[model samples]
Target: MSVFVTVVLFLVLAVAVNADIEVDCGHTEVKVRWSDPRSQMEPSLLKLGTCSPNSFYDGKAVFNVNLEDCSFRRMVTGGQVIFLNDLTHIYDPAFSQPVVCAFERHSDWSPPLYTPKFNTYGYSNLVFQMGLMNADFTGPALSSAYPLGSLIPIMAAVYQSSHQPLLLHMEECFAAMTPQPQPDSPVYPIITNKGCLVDSKSTNSRFQTRERTSEMHLLLQAFKFPLGEDVYIHCKLMAWDPEGLDSSKKACHFVKGHGWELLDDPARSDLCRCCDSHCMARRKRGLASGQGVMQKTVLGPLTIIDGSTP
Candidate 1:
């Protein structure tokens, strides 16, 4: 009878220790830690929607997520906003009471509204504008809904009064859930390296040639993001001398049958090979550090009804 009682006590302690879940919330981030009493528990068992825990160490599941990321369910009531997320264990049958996190949106912070990136003297007297365009790349888009897998023509332009003769380059771009891209908001990369159409690496996205060099037509596709249904395109736009077309500055797209191709001059396609790995500047320049004619353009809240539910 004493041996039986000892076994029962150990099992009770094991269950109690394994079920402990702690949630820590900050202004912009949340950290979740779950203790594991069983040595056989795997990190894949715990999930935050489609996101896995950031790390698992020392018999503990450690999850770090931004408040605005992972599509935390948001609702408004009484002029206040609330965000909530529930955690689930994929394989744990006894985990009926899943851990949950809910918090009121901070009164001090909200998503910033974006305006047309017009002429800015600070950015080296450059006039910038970005928007969704028509299929022919002639003008702005007219429809509200776009079919899934269809092309999305996102155009960006720079108007310069003086003929400084600067070549435009898009270094990187990501699709977000909101108009104002924040530091912690979740994002999906569409372009990378100096100008690699990384999304085209998987989907049917590429750059269309326009007559004018100032304007660029990025042909993207409509899809449902893991974070949210809404999509925003934010890009880092830079202007450099045409003579200064270095590896750090390029426009490239991956062809289905072929490899990476440079948009401006296909002869120098070698410059974009770094897109497969990483793009590093030969030297640190003031422009790359944020002082040059570089600006971030946010275009979206783009209406994409990609998926429908009955």
Candidate 2:
């Protein structure tokens, strides 16, 4: 399962009051900084589970906690992986705020970003694979070479050898300069907001018809960024109920004048409307027991030749 925890933060660039705070979500940790410009907020007065404020700097009380520590509650829903916690204070008996952090599996080749909570029963046997595909989509692309502006067909599949009924969805995708994107790596958004193909808004990139519920396809247009070097594509793949198609869980693409349209079933394209804005995720009630809903895979080192160069 994949997960994103809601870390509520009250931020102001231009101005703010005494209770103002800022949050920063790292690859394997969550940081909360309470600004005390007036020296009104005391570090000892605040707490996150059993963790106390770790430091005081820049007139702020800082709490930096690991994702797995500080009494974090592990949760999973429909493939999202998440850890949750709450901040309690002696200052206000009724005041409480949630703290959350989440991370996805990058790939077998990449280093582990954070430890995931596995089911007490068993680990997910579900196998996922992604690769560059040939133009006809008949087989894997013989070469990972594409001229700028050319379409790069990417095929992602969940090998359901047991023939289990499963529907695969691309949750999010981004292009990076490195095959294994680090937390600090600069990235270009290709698909965002669950399955919205944001790159399609500017180019011909978009999702294609799926051959099976366990498979997803994307025709990504090559770009000139980083100019003649290789680009890597990373995507979060999800497996969900075949009938549980919701706005936050869909494959949508921009159609120029038609706005966003679903790839598999345009009849339910209304779900694609959320692609224009934020898609409200379902409330996380508990832990993802087994092979929850999501898996992130990598595809790349694909060469992009800028046609303008030669």
Candidate 3:
């Protein structure tokens, strides 16, 4: 009987895991229904009150909110856009406030920028980090050399991986590793938008750092020959600006020329296991890799009065 009970419990757990969750945001007139992409489930109740002046709404997969003045702001997986209206609300003070919000899936990565909120008057925090992945970080030093013809995926933690969370998009990206060890800089090949686009409002929403690690995965496999040298990885992160304004001028700084040792050993050897089969599979599929793998985990309707909390 105990064994049978255990089997029943396992089956129940499996079914629950496969079950889909839906979100329905409504008040009296407007209604928006959204279901989880992973499963096909029915809609459930999810009420969204007045969001704070500047905060992100994670209650629904895709949603649109009607402002106090009847104007609306829509948040969808495709992207986010704002529609301006002339007549602002006089009775409902919410409309006049500098309220800007985005609805995105939750993540473990730190916030993208360290600013007040996504839609604040002045919010700018753009930075990224890179590091090597070894089975044992405390064990003997590991080699960065990867086998020739194989792909090297260097994990990158952009804005969302920092303590500061700001709203920004991944305008551009590039990675380079030194083939031959030396002092003078070598011309490293440039790549763009290869992996995930680190953006707060994009479908690939950058999440809090404590929840996720390495928001971007960069693949390096441009070397034509297996040269014997120290492999150094350098990555650059740029901010995405939709309004066609200067990103740097707006404080959306770009990271460039920063280098990190990918593989420390002088030569490639058996001691080095610097390859990712899953990453290789992703490359083979060609684009659309990790589409929904790394998303923000929804806890509940989070009403953050202070958007500038570490």
Candidate 4:
């Protein structure tokens, strides 16, 4: 009788274990639904205290869960955009156990207006390092899909990379501006006739002093409707490593030259000429004063063909 009772107890325990499921599907779905409060909150709860067909609302929140092999799919319904930052977590079986995951959504997604590609010449290579503020601009600019501001960080990076004294040769520069209406009437100015200078001189006796120079020309113009607004074009010639050089040491120097000039009569073989005689003159003087010759290095010019409206 004692042996019979022991076998019966083992059978009961096995049955109980089979009935217990680790995953609670209903509870998991409920948690996901609750985490997306934006979908459930009444329009009256909005800061405006009302919701309309055009009412826009955005919220950022996180949810943690454990799941396995999770993935997500998104679609637009009723002209509303919904972004599931981490769609995989919901489908992940691992999420069925208790774990933390993140979810974020925004009603407004501002796509880029214009993007430009960075052109390289000869054996030159382009290196880009974007600051936190302009990180969004790098990828789009390289693809030529986003506007001019998006390339600012890229420009900074390229300018910093040129081993020789650089110049902002504006003859090849291009600018694209989005023609959106603005309250401040801000204009995006284009750069024309820009170039950079790089000083390769070493101050210490252990290293040799060398001077290198390159020249380029490009056209820059601000994006403005009237095309005659008082637009300002700001250009900077910074050291490759400003911190590495002493403040008193000049890494590179820049000097502006004459603008576009008419080549006498149009009947002449040359219709027009843009000369940087002043730059050449300054370079000669520098060389005479112990600065080395200006070595020509090729950095591809960026050209802007048109403006955008988005």
Q: List per-candidate RMSD values in Å.
A: 17.3, 15.8, 22.7, 24.7
Q: Report the lDDT tens digits of candidate 1 across residue range 177-205.
A: 76556789887888887778899888998
- The per-model lDDT (C-alpha) reads 0.66, 0.69, 0.27, 0.24
Worst 10 residues of 3 by lDDT: 6-15
Q: Output the number of the lDDT-best candidate.
A: 2
Candidate 4 per-residue C-alpha lDDT over 1-310 given as tens digits, one digit per residue, 9 for 90 to 100: 3522111100111111112111112212201211233344432222100001123234322222322112111223443322222222222323221212222223443222223333222112322221111334324234322243222233323333435443222221222222122456543333222221211011100101122223222212212233312111223322222122221112222222422322111132121221222222122223233222222221112223224543
Name the candidate that leads on TM-score: 1
Residues 1-310 of candidate 2 have per-residue lDDT tens digits of: 7965443323222211225566666656778877656645565667775467898666667788876555555544443455566676757767567765555532222222333221111115577777788897887787766888999888887765454477888889998876456799788999899889999999999888887888888899997678755576778877776777888778999998988898879988999888777988764221153223677666655678877665
Worst 10 residues of 1 by lDDT: 5-14
Error of 1 at 126 (Å): 0.9
Off by over 4 Å in 1: 1-122, 182-184, 226-228, 282-292, 307-310
Using alpha carbons, what is the TM-score of model 1? 0.58
Per-residue lDDT of 247 in model 2: 84
TM-score versus the correct structure, for each prediction: 0.58, 0.57, 0.25, 0.21
How many clashes in candidate 3? 22
lDDT pick, better of 2 and 3: 2
